[model samples]
Target chain A: MTTQAEHRMPTAALPADASGLLPAAEPIRFLDDDGGPAPGDAHGRYQRPATELLRQAYRAMVVGRRFDSQATALTKQGRLAVYPSSRGQEAGEIGAVLALRDTDWLFPTYRDTMALVSRGIDPVEALTLLRGSWHCGYDPTTTRTAPQCTPLATHAPHAVGLAYAARRRGEDTVALALVGDGGTSEGDFHEALNFAAVFHVPVVFLVQNNGYAISVPLSRQTAAPSLAHKGVGYGVRGERVDGNDPVAVLAVLGDAVESARAGGGPVLVEAHTYRVEPHTNADDDTRYRDHDEVEMWKRRDPIARLEAHLRTAGELTDDDVSAAREAAEAFADDVRTRLGEEATGDPADLFAHVYAEPTAQLREQARWLAEELAHEHGAGEAR
Target chain B: MTLTMGKALNAALRDALREDDSVVVFGEDVGPLGGVFRVTDGLTAEFGEERCFDTPLAESGIVGLALGMAMNGFRPVVEMQFDAFAYPAFEQLASHVAKMRNRTRGAVGLPMVIRVPYAGGIGGVEHHSDSSEAYYAHTPGLKVVTPATVADAYSLLREAIADPDPVVFMEAKKLYWSKDETGLPVRTAPFGTAEVRRAGSDATLLAYGPTLPVALQAAEAAAGDGRQLEVIDLRTLVPFDDETVAASVRRTGRCVVVAEASGFASVSAEIAARVQERCFHSLWAPVLRVTGWDIPYPPPVLEKYHLPGVDRVLDTVDRLQWDDAPDSRFLSGAAT
Candidate 1:
């Protein structure tokens, strides 16, 4: 994007670069059609993530794909409420998440199962939210990962506040908030960007511009040159990276996270990517998108790009690919076993977490529920 | 020290900051200007800028940042500046702060206090005076409270800050200047408890926040006319002290609730419903509510007419029949 647009700054200049907000022209990319290194200063500075990181990214993408398929199959099997698969955009999710330290937080949207899986959350636990179960599948405090936020961009400010509060306590915890392009239109997104910049909070925002938010496409989402450009108005450093290129996403996100940890202001990175599947099982892509467009994006698939690069470099053999597939299948089988059990929901689950200290009214309500459940079960113990 | 509501609130905030380093206080002009009403006056001077400070004029950002801070272990006490000015942050309050802990299933709790200066009769402009306790009370995960006494103001606010859940603490704007002797007794009722401010034999008056003093005055006027009226201060609105109000109603057999929020779907309505449910047999008269008219808060000059005053409370009490129980449906607005 060109150096354009005026800031809505009302106070002292925010924590931003002093110069004008001129973001890079195209998404910063490092890999080509044949997986050769591209040319650019950012590209030259080793946008090539370490070989180990790439290998892990490859594994994560494969497992993420398998997990996505399993979730979709479970929904078909009458298991989950819904599943927003991160199919074509696995690299964007995994690349940025792997850059975060264990102490750091990864705030995921409903569509970001890949982030949770890559962050070491159990495959079964990761799908629990989709399974219509209680709680956010995993312990957020233990894993430093927030629950799946269904509301668009709401978690952005939370991530900023967490990082800001962490710094106040003399902790060096970075927060990476992930969102879709459509989420950037939300008021919470604007507030989060402004507050994060104003407070110099240690947070990195990653907008996986997955081409469409359900049926709403990117063009209808914003009038700005690009989603990343919207960040500069809040006085945050805005950059665009190739979502399909795992190396570039890792390099850019890694740099942003490191810079934030060292007290650099919060940054916004938009990864240009696509959601190859329907928004969920509930949406129809054919209504708004052309088949040719889907075909076009298939050629640019993140996993295929990475796998080709790995194979061409002789870093990944055919047997290794087969082994990766076998591991992914094993994970899917484990998730299937966990989800196959009959749901024996507890009657008290509704009132359990409403407060750390349940009020008199809530306690009374819980009592009523217990008694009613007991009566229904012929005076059996309240489940 | 004889403390007004504002000074009592200041003392509470001061005590909280002194007690916990994790507690932070911030809002517009809270740092140097001591807040628009001086509730946070000198707090920044006593505590450093880190513990107490100012923020931008954006209310949404203020509350959002505070929620974020709370999620990360900081007990943030944010001022809404004015009652209606807090509307901008309603989305954040309802969607995030109020539901974070429950939605996260006990993994994260929003232990913060959102202080709003609410109520009419303060002769302030449009958005300056509003009674929004009902909105917070309606939200599931929040504890809505308003203290009508100086002791409760000091003690309730300190407890709210220390509570392990979010509390929407409404500071009655009109009561900010109402004073009481502070050194007599520092003891105050804990949150979710109701104390009978006055005692009598005929009827019970249920009121909270800005309407408590009005109910007290109405009780005094009723006494001159040989009609005994007891006053109950419902300091907490959410986990409402139903037992106190219900028991009083059972004994007196008559009731009238007063408030500055509109007559429709209000916190007053909530208390009235609960009292009706718990004391249906003992009730001699259907509960009556004396509240602001079902209209947007009018201009400052006409606020007196809109707010329930002593006369309105008395008029509602007079409408309560000692002979027969009236239809409960008509109890919400018959007197007005």
Candidate 2:
């Protein structure tokens, strides 16, 4: 009963942005890779991020990289089960967090420890899932952040639902979901976009196009013009930015988040970046990638680019850089000392928290486990 | 007031939505159309769009939306529309909804319900009929409940929505039109307890959801043969009522599990094993099972042969050891 034209009819109005469906001709850049100011005409699509925010982002990137390395070392020491380092992509990671207010919600992926750290969450709690102590360490409601989701793109719809609920409650809350390039290929990604667009909820889908999903290249992920272009079909405004450029990432993401907050509907921003490290500690970069490719991305490091620009503009002094590095080393040292100690958890905790009120079966099983532990240790105590 | 099980379920949802401002219902065709089965009929008219609405026909998105809304302080009751169609949302249900509370160390509890119209016997074609309760029951951290009677349908649904955990509430499609004289807001025994629909002394007939009616009918037919069959309706599949079922099986010394699903590694199979394990010395014979054949759901014309009927249940009940067994049966290892 439906015709092709009727099926093709646009579901909602075009996004309120002037650029409409297509993104900027080039990835929006406010700073060149060498840390010099980009050509003014090249970044006319968005304004440069503020100096204060840029300085903050730069220091956070420094601390974030140190945290990343510390967690990687903990993995080798068996303190953590595994760690996914966001080393080269710190700009997009920190920029996404810096763009949002504490009242807003953030949905992070397993590779987004830097974003959580930038959100002011304790570094220890942020690494809990990777530490193997619990599935999620921090309370999501208290932190206004969801657990770091491991399944790719599955949290996209959750962001949409939460954002929609906030709107229905008459609150000006926006949800920003951090996703990888490979996540764009998932069905949840498209479904979440469509739902957000249809409801016109406040949400920002930030896709950090970090070149690869594990060893699979982006070429195999999609053949579209760009990950951002895929948003056009869902009537969401699409924007692309140089993820390595801190100024561009913050500027574009800030615009997208604020625009969604003002009810301009959801916006999908694609950050063109690269992952310098392997997927995780267990993965071998040499198997599917070249050392030369890793070396090339290392040259375009996000931290070095932003630090150079800030120093030239006199926004960061020599003393400020030293203070930043010193703070980072102290933070890493604290983390190392704390991680060296073994984690202690009660065995009974396994039966706890499965339900709000434990079922009879759970109670019986818990009792059985308690008795087993008692007999095994010859202790008279029963939990 | 006389009520059909379907209408009772509708009344329960209406009452729950009225009592809780945080409660919202949404799914494909749930709004405006009032659901294809009409169980959700007239909800949108009473609650307005924010409370009851339609969604894109993606099952995963529907359930995923419930997870998010629940996280943000909303009790979302989502409909899977059918039994087999819910497979698309299994990842969301199993990975997030079922595990969110435990995953967060009890920081998050999803007070949501996934309504699935399940089981065979209305002569419906494939995909429309499936007994998928075992999948949810096997997954930890989810409460799986199904209602057979009109009163139980209203009571259990209200309980499921109020519980601070995710529940997979399966509605037996075949029993939807069956009627009783129960009024709105009727209360029944809470979940995790089985109800004895018929009490007897010879053997126990254990069933749930769609198979409860078949078991009761078989009991009535067995009465004509001087067999007193005790029928137990296991309303809640998970957190199963081990005490009630074991007590009845111990008294009767025999149990036959009746279900519309295939018997292999199923909810019925689980009940049979548990009853035997708990009451091994008291059991007069090995537990028997009457269930659908192990195959994909068949066309409407062939479903009658594949589904368990009263005759099949009675035949399985006949296999239970009795004092009247022939002498030759002892030589065949068929006697206790």
Where model 1 places Cα greater than 4 Å from the true spot, the runs are A1-21, A39-46, A379-383, B323-336
Extract clashing residue pairs from model 1: none
What would the C-alpha RMSD of candidate 2 be, to one decimal place? Answer: 4.3
> What value does the lDDT take at residue A187 in candidate 2?
89
Consecutive 10-residue window with the lowest summed lDDT within model 1 chain B: B322-331
Worst 10 residues of 2 chain A by lDDT: A1-10
What does the lDDT read for residue B218 in candidate 1? Answer: 93
Q: What is the lDDT of residue A291 in candidate 2?
A: 95
State the lDDT of candidate 2 residue by residue for A227-286, as single tens digits.
999888888889999999998899999999999998788999999999998999999988
Cα lDDT computed for each candidate against the true fold: 0.85, 0.89
Candidate 2, chain B, TM-score (2 decimals): 0.96
**What is the DockQ score, from 0 to 1, of model 2?**
0.55
| Per-residue accuracy of model 1 over A10-54 as CA lDDT, tens digit each | 246554563444458778888874466665564634446788888
Candidate 1 residue B76 C-alpha distance from true site, Å:
0.8
